[model samples]
Target: MEKPKEKPIIELKNVLKKYDDKTVLQNVNLVINKGEFVTLLGPSGSGKTTILRLIGGFEWTTRGEILFNGLDIKDLSPHMRDVSTIFQDYALFPHLSVENNIKYGLRLKRINLPRESIKPSIYKKQKNLQKKWAKEAKDAMKKLDKIQAEYEKELTKKKLPKNKLVKIQQWLDDSDFKYASWEVWPSLMNEKFEKKYLTRKITNDEMDKIVKDVIKLVNLEGHEKKSIDQLSGGQKQRVALARSIVIEPSLLLLDEPLSALDAKIREQMQQFLSDIQKKLGITFIFVTHDREEALRLSDKIAIMRDGVIEQYGTPKEIYDYPVNKWIANFIGDSNIFEGKIIDNDEEIISILDQKIKYWSKYKFGQNEVVDVLIRPEDIEIKKSKGLIKGIVETIVYQGSYYMIEVKHKQYKILVESASEFEIGQKVYLDWTITSMHLMTQEKEKNKNKDTVSLNLKLNKEEISNE
Candidate 1:
């Protein structure tokens, strides 16, 4: 027999949501497939949350249809939609115990039946159910451990040639695992080590264990049972995630979930979220105002402005080939210059600046105003080795990277470098023509329009060697 075909869990068709006299969402169309995790990312007032609210049935769309599994759900109440939403703040009931708070959704279903007619307290049933799931999780963890050991043994079994072993040892050394000096690897190791170590640390029947296990896919283990008041901002956010995933919803919606966390925690959460999404294969829609987070977490991202999708594609496409200027700047730091395009060759472009020419894949007509976007990381920073020389204005350390701001010819541009360059020191900025992102010259003319593209003009062929 042929397998049954799966349908999209949520489909938004030409959705337009507007407040009186203001349109928050415009012709919004999206399809969320079953088990797919998608994120909606944009700045404040960009209508990220509006989409979430519409999906959740908290608000009605001015125009369009919302379908769930081929059935129109536009008029369904929030509770009728099988989807679940996780807010940044833990919206647990203060009067209820942790376990009860979690089962509130299930309890709400029971309210219609005679309260006394129910066979068992929801807590009692939930406890038993939790115990059953706990046992299953424990067994799964053990299986994971066995698999890991088998792999490790296989790695050790290869009585490799002396040189091969030496090479492997060098590789481990370079990875710093050899120097880690821990009895067991960090919880971040494969599922096997995690199961073996964490299982030993907590009871299988522990509610905390269930929460921890859900977050384990996100690389967060331990620290369960800690009150929300005692946790760090990031930890609290992860706790919220743990709580949400513990129930395993088929559709998960995250709206700027990590916005309040510190930078360190945010980075950790980013990786964790990616790992969890892959492991669960559940449909996840994340809404965020952070471009970097969107780029990092999304398989395909849609850039939204004023409730409309400006552009949508893979991160590389959005970053390397933005259709307009606002999108280019929104995705990453860019240096933009405006000048008329005087030459067009499929692989090269000439700007009217006379001093600057670029090599790119996109072509524009002569006299066409064009925009150029060059990422800070793409520009070469060095002493006495660039097309333009400028005095260092500022240097900021960003953990693994350094950002240097340089002023040249009254124009200040930021450049990223691994090695630190001193303030007041003269530095040259050199960028290859291939690094340029070219856009249509009509940006300025369309500037007054919502979502206008900016024009960037490049000057100088190459930095001279001193």
Candidate 2:
């Protein structure tokens, strides 16, 4: 799909929001570029919902700037911000039909969107500019003529040569010489339209065309007249999406929209949302606790904890290279080893007490205390020569695979495999070189700040001696 992306469409800078005596959000900073699918992945009460409300202008930020398209939107209302949200409950009208529910935003009472008129505003400006431009152009030409005559008089008085006149007419002769283009005037954008498509200004034909197009986009073409009570959970979800999308918002917020659907239906809607985001090429911010759903639907992921973002990166980066033990425990399943780096090599690291050789994808300093992470599926238990000896402590059957817990001294390693090993059986634990993830502890990671290099000036004595 062709995504006609631009610079950041929404920015929340140092945003702090509080509800009465409680602070739900604090020092939240984020930038969402155009046409990117971003997910806010975290558990409940992590301030994901609060972020959406702030972006939608439903709730104002207590202490920071909310910018839309590089301009501060502190005074813009929800209707003027051109943002749309689909909530967890779908938020459809129970008494209305699917078509009417889709039309709810167009209805005068529900959303009350103002109409956008492009031509009349631009055309009026163009007309006024044309009138204004004529006098300016005439005055400029007259000034040029006056300068030319003065130069000629100077030339006659001083008896100068005709060859010195080349630089005087540069501006008059240059067609591409730039004056402030009329397009950038403060009045170019129409304030009366309110960045909306109103019901009153739209004719019945235009309204029907717009409503039908959005319904077709949501795949509700034949079920327009069907009542909301008559539709399935998936259909109702789509109706909610259609209602939000019909207004053509610059940013779309989805707050656990598939929480009500069955597993299979929810999976289907995940793909549906991804496809729609690509097809529409609009910035989509999805909020959900489901890790798999967020990984599957978003291009970037922001993981939050206790109303703060713990980490933000691509899904693969979050899964493979978690910053701290807390994030490793939250994002996916893994076995962790707490040991000091005894020997660092080109491709391996030896942990002294563990008597185990780690398959290192990163280099660690000698004697550095760090954590090593290995996914459960990466561990290979077999009779072949292995890195360490382990005793199988427990076996768990998990449908497609069996999870085996092995105890090696002070560490308990988890491994996932198809064959179940007997409990208390001695087995060899081994893993590939590329599968191990080395991480710095939270405090250590924070201590590694970005530094800049500078060039020093030599002293005057040294310079004189040189």
User: Residue 58 in model 2: shift from native, Å?
Assistant: 1.2
How many clashing residue pairs, candidate 1?
18
lDDT of 1 by residue, 1-466 (tens): 9845656899999998889978889899988778665777677888988888888777878888777666566534344466777786656454544333443443322113344654465546555655665565566656655755554564686576777667655554443222221212221232232233222332335544454455564444554344455556776666566566665667778878888888887898888878877787767888888888888888777788878887877788898888888888888888776656655543334432335667666556766767877789998999877778889999999999889899887677889999988999988888887787787643333325443322111112222322
lDDT, residue 332, candidate 2: 84
Highest TM-score scorer:
2
* Per-residue accuracy of model 2 over 111-187 as CA lDDT, tens digit each: 34433534467556656655665656656656656876676566555555556655544543442222222222222
Please give each candidate's TM-score. Answer: 0.65, 0.73
CA displacement after TM-score superposition, residue 380 of candidate 2 (Å) = 2.2
Best by lDDT: 2
Relative to the true structure, candidate 2 reaches a TM of 0.73
